[model samples]
Every structure is written in C-alpha cells, then in structure tokens.
Target: MSNEDIYLCIIGLCIVSYIPRVAPFLLLGKRQMPHAFELWLKYVPTSVFGALIFCSIFQTDSGVDFSFSNISMLAAIPVLAVAAKTHSLPYSIIVGLAAYWGLQQVM
Candidate 1:
C-alpha cells in the first residue's frame, strides 16, 4: 500500500478503537444513575479482588497443584482472616507479605 493509504488505515484504526472507549461516557451525559446500577457498582471492587486472589493463589508456573507446598496459599489464609477481622489494608498486606517471606525462608 502507498504511504498515504497506510496512514489513513492507521487513522481509521485509531478512530475505531477510540469510539468504543469514549462513546459510553459521552452518551451517558448528565443522566442520573439508577439505584440498581449504583448497587451493582458497589460490588465491583469485591468481585475484582476475589478474582485476583483466586488467580494468584491457584495459578502456578507448571500447572494447578493444590499441594501442601503452596506457601503463598497457606499464608493467605491467616492474612485473609486478619483482613476480615481488622478491616485494615496496610496491616493485611504487610502481614501477608511478611508471612509469605518467612514461610519461604523456612521451607
């Protein structure tokens, strides 16, 4: 293809990709958000965290192995319990990471 044609193709691709991302906010405009939608939005964080934790805990280099040697998974149990009990982000992260490190050192 000619240089001009390639440039036009790139411009077209950019516009196509940008429309899906930008169109939603532009179309939503000043409309009031519905109650159900607002309620659903509240659960997004929890759902995202649960998915992330599940991915991290169960995923391994070779394959899915739920053996006793999974130190990170083991340490996360207490970390999750502490987080649920105290509702503290910093403390939970610190304790979880430290516990993982300690466990790794000993094993």
Candidate 2:
C-alpha cells in the first residue's frame, strides 16, 4: 500500500487495539467495587496461572501422568512449596528452575 494508506491502516489498528485496553480503565477508574468482589478478584491471577501450569506439569506424551517420574510434576512440588511458604515469585521461580535443572541432571 501507499504511505498514506499504510499510515491510515496503522492508525486504525492502533485505535482498534487501544480501545479495548483503555475502556476498562475508563469505565472502572472512578468506580468503587464491592469488597467481596474485590476480594474474589485476588484469586484470578493465580487461578489462571495454575490452570496453565497444571496441564504442562501433569500431562505427558501418552496421557496425564501423576507419577514421580514426571519431571515437571516433580519440579512443581518445590516450586509450589516455595511459593506458598515464602509468597515470593522470584524464589519460586528460582526453586522451580533449580528443581527442574537438578531433576534433569539426575533423571
């Protein structure tokens, strides 16, 4: 496309992408949510995170594997423990990487 056409397309794309992201802030910025709903929202991120990780940790090439031989499953134990005990993402990540790496070394 020509320069003007390309610029118009870029502007249109920016507007389309920006509206959805900005709409939430504009709509909710001045509002006060109920306390219970706000508290409920706290679990959203970790729930989503756990949903994503659960499949990778438990699933194998053949099927769902819950056995100790599953490295990701094994690694997740300490990762979860560190996350729960310390409530630190960096520590959990470090423990996860260390667990996965150490497991990779041995088994």
Candidate 3:
C-alpha cells in the first residue's frame, strides 16, 4: 500500500478506536445516570481487569496451563488470598511480585 493509504488507515483506526469510548461520555454529559446503571458501572473495571489478566496468567505457548510450572498462575494464588483478606492493592501487588519472583527463582 502507498504511504497515503497507510496514513488514512491510521487515521481511520484512531477514529474507530476512540468512538466507543467518547460516545458514552458525550451522550451522558452532565446527566444523572440511573441507580442501577451506576451500580453496574462499578463492576466494569473489575471485569475488564479480570478479562485482561485471565489469558496471560492461565495460558502459555503450547496451550492453557494451570500447572505449578506457570509462575504467573502460581503467583496469583497468594496474591488472590492476600487481596481478598486485606483488600489492599499495594499489598496485593507486593505479594504478587514477590510470589512471581520467588517462583521464577525456584523454577
């Protein structure tokens, strides 16, 4: 493809990528959202985070990996426990990194 085509594709991609994100704010600007909808929005970040983390933690080059060999999955065990018990992001992060580092050293 020519440079012009590449530039146009990039611009088109930028527009498409931004529309979904911007449209909601534009449509909802300065308006009070319903209680149910507001309650539901609270879960969006958690769900999105889980979706993003699930694949990297659970999968590998060959296929799905749930074994102890996967340090990420192994590390997640203590992270989950600490996060649930403490409900603290910093503690969870520290535990996760430490767990992963320790597992990496051992394995």
lDDT of each: 0.88, 0.91, 0.91
**How well is each residue in 1-107 modelled by candidate 1, as lDDT tens digits?**
99999999999999999996886697677676788977997899899999999879877997775887998788898899999999999989999999999899998
Quick one: ranking by lDDT, best first? 2, 3, 1
* Best-fitting candidate, scored by TM-score: 1
lDDT of 3 by residue, 1-107 (tens): 99999999999999999997997788786777789988998999999989888987998899999887889898999999998899999999999999999998999
lDDT, candidate 3, residue 52?
A: 80
Residue 40's lDDT in candidate 3: 93
Model 3 misplaced stretches (Cα beyond 4 Å): 1-30
Q: Could you report the Cα RMSD, in angstroms, for every candidate shown?
A: 7.3, 6.2, 4.7
- Residue 41 of model 2 has an lDDT of 78
Question: TM-scores of all models?
Answer: 0.66, 0.64, 0.63
Mind giving the per-residue lDDT tens digits that candidate 2 earns over 1-107?
99999999999999999996896688696887788977987999889988899998998899999998999999999988888899998999899999999999999
Candidate 1 worst ten-residue window by lDDT: 23-32
